[model samples]
Target: MFPLSTSINLTLPIEDPILKFLLILVIILAAPLILNKLKIPYLLGLIIAGAVIGPHGLNLVLRDSSIILSGTAGLLYIMFLSGLDMDMSDFKHNSWRSLVFGLYTFCVPLGLGILAGHYLLGFPLYSSILLAGLFASQTLIAYPIVSKLGIARDKSVTISVGGTVITDTLALLLLTIIVGMATGNVDDHFWWRLTLSVVLCIVVIAVLFPLLAHWFFKHVSDNISQYIFVLALVFLGAYLAQLAGLEPIIGAFLSGLALNRLIPRTSPLMNRIEFVGHAIFIPFFLIGVGMLIDYRAFFRDWESIEVAAVMILLITAAKYIAAFLTQKTFRLSKDQRTVIFGLSSAHVAATLAAVMVGYNVILGYTPEGEPIRLLNESVLNGTILMILATCTISTFATQRGAHNIAMGNAQESDDDRSRRPEEHILIPVANERSAEELVAMSIMLKKPRDPNGLYALNAIDNRVEDPNVEKRARKILDAAASAAAGSDIYLQTLLRYDVNISNAIVSVARERNITDIVMGMHHMTPAVPGIAGIPVPAGPAIGRMAADVLGHSNITTFLYNAEQPLSTVKRHLIVVPEKAEKEAGFQMWMNRIHQLARNSGAKIIVFAPASTMPYLRTFGRRRPANIDFVVFEQWDDLPSLEHDLRQDDCLWFVMSRRERVSYHPAMSRIPLYLEQYFAGYSYVLLYPVQAGPGDSRYL
Candidate 1:
C-alpha cells in the first residue's frame, strides 16, 4: 500500500459547489447500476462512494455547509417517511409486540455495548453509557427494499417498524441525557424542562398538527399546494422538536403520524411526498454519511480496526439475541426472525449523531495532563466501519428473509398461487363525465387483498398533434384518478398517442398484465350512405372502439351504461347465460359481482339455469355475499327480467364472447333488448375472458 502522506496529497479538494453537486449526482446515478451488477446493495454502495470521495480519502471534496444542510434534510426525510409509510392500523394492533421487541433490541445492545466500551476498550463510565446508547439506535435503511417487494404490510415488517420508533426514541433520549451530563448541566431543572417541553411538543404535534392538516386539506383545492403544505408541516414539526430540546427527527416522525389519516397511503399527495424524498433528500443524506469516513484511518492505526471489529461483533450479536428471543416468544418463523434482525441491525443517523456529540464533549483529563475526549478519532473511524458492515449485513439479511417469507407464503396455498397473479385492472377513460364511474367500477371489481393498483389510460389519436388535446386527455384522466384517490384507491395515470384508442388500450393492458378492463359503453354514430354503409347497426349496439377492445382483449371486460350513479342504485339484477358457470373467467366475474354487491350494499338477484345456481350458491357460501338465485331455465327469457327490474336497479348481463363455451345466440340480442325494455335502468354487460380448460373449478 502507498504511504498515507502520498495518498492524502494526490487529489485536490473540489471547491466549486456545482462540481461537488455534479460529483454526488454522478455517484448516485452510477453507483447503483455498478453495485447491483456486483450483487452489492446500492445503499451500501452509496456509503462506500461517500468514503472514497470524502475528505479523509483523497481529500477530493470537503464536508461543506451545503452538504450538511442537504444531509440533515435527508436524515429528517428518512424518519418522516418511516412513520408515513407504516401501516398505522397494523402498527397499532402490534403495539405491544413492538414494545417487547423495542425493550429487547435496546437493552441487549446497550448492555453489550457498555461491556465492550468499558472492559474491552477501557472507556470511562459515562462515556461507556453514551456509547451503549449509540449502539442501541438503528436506522431502517432496508425498509425501502421491503416496500419495493410489496411486503411492507407483512406482520413481521409491521412489528419491526413499530419497534424502531420505541428503540430510537429511547436511544435519542439517552443521548440527550448523556450530553446534558457531560456538559455539566444534568440538574433537576434540566430534567423538568426536558419533560415539560417534550410533553408539550407531543401534544402540539399529535393533536394540533393533525387538526391543522385536516382543515388545510379540506380547504386546499390545488394538488401541488397540498403537497407543499404537507412538506412545510414536516419541517415545521422538525423545528418545533428542536425547540423542545429533542432531536428534529422525533418531530418529523410525529408529523408523519399526525397526517397519516389525512394523506391516504395511495393518494397522489403521498406519491409526491415519497418521490421528492427518495429522489433527492434521502440520497443526499446518505452521501453525506459516506463523506465522514476516512479510509486511510484503518491503515494508519490498528486500534481503529480492533475498535470497529468489537463494535460490529457486539452490535450484531446483541441484535441477533434480541431477534432470537422475540422469535421464540412470538413463535415466528426463522425467516421472520432473520428479517427483524436485518431491519434492526443498521447503524446510521442516530448513531452518528450520538457519536459526534460524545466526540465534541470533554470528559476528563488523562494521566499525562492531556484532555481526554469522550470519543476519540479511533472510535469515530470504528463507528464508520461499523456502519458499513451492519448496512451490508442488514441489506442481505433483509432481502433473503423477505424473499423466503414471500416464497413460503406462496407455497402454502395452491389456490392463492393460481388466483393471485398480481391483479392489475386497466380502465380506458374516454368520456370525461363517465370516467369517474368507470374507475369506481374498476375499484369495486379489484381484488381487495391485492397490492396491485389501477391504471387509468387516456389515449389521444395520433392524427391530433395539438398539445392541447393531450392536455385535455391528461386532465380527464387526472379527474378520474382524483376520484379514485378519495376512496383510498391507487390509480396510475397513463397517456398514450395512438392512431386507434382500442389498439392503445390493448397494448397497455398486455404490457401491464391487466386482469380486467372496465370501460364506459359508447354508441356508434351511423355512417353516411354509400361511403361506408352501416356495417353493423349503430343505434342500439356498442361503439366501434368498445367492440374492437372487447374483440381483441382476452382479459375480462365490463361495459357500463349507467342510467343513474352507481352509488344510488338499490339493487343488482344479473342475468347469466347457459353454461356460464363452465367458462374460465366465471370465478373472476363472480368475484367481481360479489365485490360490487358488497361495495354498493345492493342485493344481487341472479337469473340463470338451475345447474348454475348450485355453483353460485357455493361461491356465495365460500366468499360470503348477499346474493339470491332465480332459476330462469332459458337463455332467451332474459327480457322477462324487466318485470322485476326497477328504475333504480342495475341490470347486469353476464354474456360470453363469440365462439366461447357460454355464448348463446340470444347474446347478440342483448343491446336491442336493453334498449327496448330496460333503457331507463342502469346496465352492465360483462364478457369474461377465455380461461384455460382446467380453470372451470368452483374455487
Candidate 2:
C-alpha cells in the first residue's frame, strides 16, 4: 500500500513528472466541472484552482520548466485561434478601423501608465517607461468566452483581433527597446539588427509560410499529418519571432494568418485544433497564470498596497478610455465598446515577462542585503495582484458584453427571417474518395442551423451473397460521417438493401424530406467502337446511373467533378442560364454558390446574359463583396469557354431538367462539351429544385 505521508516532500512539489502531469490532467478535467456549479466562469475557475494548488497555496505543484513551456504554448494558441477563426472578409473591410483602434488602445494605456508610474509610484524614468509598456500590452484571456457565446464571427470580434495584432506588436517592440537600453545593448548596430531581422522574419512568415502550407495541404491527404504540419509551422514561426526580437505570440498569430485560407472553419482539422486547445493547452495556461499569484504579498506592506492599487487602476482606466475613444470614433454600440475594453484590459503575458526582466536587472544593493533592482520585489508582487484583478475584471466585462450581443443577434435574426424552409440535404456515398469530397461540398451548401438536416445514404446489394457487401457500405458511411463531423456538422447515415442504388437514394430522400442531393460525377459512360475500333463514349458524358438519378430525383441536385482541392480554388467561374431566375430554385442555387465562395475565400466571376446580371448583382450585394459579372450571351457555345478557363478556377454550370423554366435545347449538349473541353478542370452541374408555391423558401 502507498503511504500518504511518504508522498509529502517539503523540498519538492510532485518530483515525479508523471505524477505532476496526472495532477494537471485531473485539474483540467475537474476544476471546470466543480466550479461550474458555483456560477463561475470555467476560465476563472481554472485560474482560482491553480492558485489553490500552487506552491504559494497548498504547495501541491511547483512552477517547473514543463509548466512554463506548456503555458507559453497556450498563450500562443490563444493568439493563433483568434487569427484562425477570424472572418477574413470582415477583417479586410475594417482594416482601417482596426488601425485606429490599435493606436487608441496602445497610446491611452501607455500615456496613463507613464504618468501613474512616475507620479503615483515615484519610479525612475526607465522603470516608469517600462511599466507604461506593460500597461499597453494585453492577452486575449476572455476570447474563449466570446467564442463559446458564438459571436466569434461578429464584426466587433474581428475589430478586436485586428487591434490586438497592432497593439501587441507595438508593445513588444517597446519592451525590446526598453530592455536594450537598461542592459547597455542600445547602439547603432542594435538598431540595424532589429530592423533587418524584423523585416526578414515578416517576409518569411507572411510570404513564404503560406506558399509552403498551400503546397503541403495540396499534397498531403491525411488529417493527422495535416494537423501536425500546422503545429510545426506555428512553433517554427514562434522561434523565428523570438530570434527577430519579437514575442513568440506574434509569430504564432502570423502563422495562423498564413494558413487561415487553407483551413476552413467547417473542416475537421479546425475542429481538432479547437478541441485540443480548449481541453488541455488553455487550461494549463490558465493554471500557470494562477500559479504566478502570491496572495500573501498583497498585504505585506504599505508599498505593496500602493503599487497594486495604482497598477490595477491605471490598467483598467487606460484600457477603458482607449476603448471608449475608439467606440466614439466608429459610432459603435455600447456592447461592442465593452467587448473591446474587456478584451484589451488583461495584462498577463507580456507584463509578466517585462516584470521579470525588471526584477532581474540589478542596479544597487540595499542595507538589508537585498538587491535593489530596477523594479523591486514590491512592484513584482504588485504585478501579480494586477494580473489577477485585471483578468477577473476582463472576464466579467467580456461575458456581460458577449451575452448581450448574442441575445441582440438572436432577436435580429428572428426578425429578419420571414420564411425559413426546413432544409435537409442528402448525400449518397459509394467510395471513400468521393465520400469526403461530397461531404465537404454538402457542408458548404447546407444551412448551418438546421441540426437534423444532413444525411448520408448507403446502398447495399441484396442479391450479392458476399458478406463484405455490408462491411464495405458501413465503411463508406463511417468515412462520410467523419468528414462531416470535422465541421461540427452531423451526418445521419442510412443503409438500405437494394440492387438499384439510385432507387434506394430516392426512397431515402422521400422518407427523410431531403431538400437537396449533392452527388459526384464518378460514373462514366460505356464505350462504343469508333472508326478504327478505338473506344468512344456511346451516349452523353454522364453514365446511365447518374441519368436515372437526375430523371427520378425531385429535389435540387448538384453533380460535382473535382480535379483539385476545392479550398485552393481562386475563382468560381459561374455560368448561369439566361432564364435561370425564372426557375423556382434560382435563389437557392445562388445562395449555395455564395456559401462556397465565402468558405473558400474565392471570388465569384459570373458569366451570364445581360438579363441575368441584375438578379445576380442583387444577391451578390448581400454577401461578401467579391463578385465580377461578364455580359456574355453565347453560353451555348460551351467550347468557347475553354480559353477563359484557368488551372485555379472552378466552373459552375447551372442547368435545368427537361421542360423546366431554364431548360433549352442547348442544355442537352453541355455535358458532352464539358467532357471534351473541361475534362481536367473542377466543375459543378447544378440542377435546381423545382419548388412549388408552398415551398418557396429554404432554411
What CA RMSD would you report for each candidate? 10.7, 4.4
Best by TM-score: 2
Give the CA lDDT, 0 to 100, for residue 117 in model 2: 90
Which residue runs of candidate 1 sit more than 4 Å off their true CA positions? 1-11, 364-369, 407-417, 420-699
Question: Which residues of candidate 2, in runs, are more than 4 Å off?
Answer: 1-12, 363-372, 412-418, 449-451, 460-467, 526-540, 625-634, 664-666, 691-699
lDDT of 2 by residue, 1-699 (tens): 985655555455677777789989998888767877887888888888889889889888998888888998898889889888877777788889989998998898889989999988899988898888888888899999998787887777888888988888898898889878977889999999999999999899989998888788778888899888988898999999999988888899889888887787667788899988888888889999999888998669989889899989988998999889988998999999999888989888878888888889887788998887878888888999999999999888998898899999889767655565666889888898889888988887765443457899888767778978888989999999988887778889998997788778878888888888998885455653322111125555565556667777667888888887776676889888887887878888887877776665567799988998898888888766456889878865878888888877889888876655666666666777877788878888888876433443421
**Over the stretch 418-464, how does candidate 1's per-residue lDDT look in tens digits?**
86676788888976888877876776676543434789999988887
Give me the displacement of residue 481 in model 2, in angstroms: 1.9
Tally clashing residue pairs in candidate 2: 1
Q: After superposition, how far is residue 400 of candidate 1 from its true place, in Å?
A: 2.1
Among all candidates shown, the one with the greatest lDDT? 2
TM-score of 1: 0.66
- As for model 1, its CA RMSD to the true structure in angstroms is 10.7
TM-score of 2: 0.91
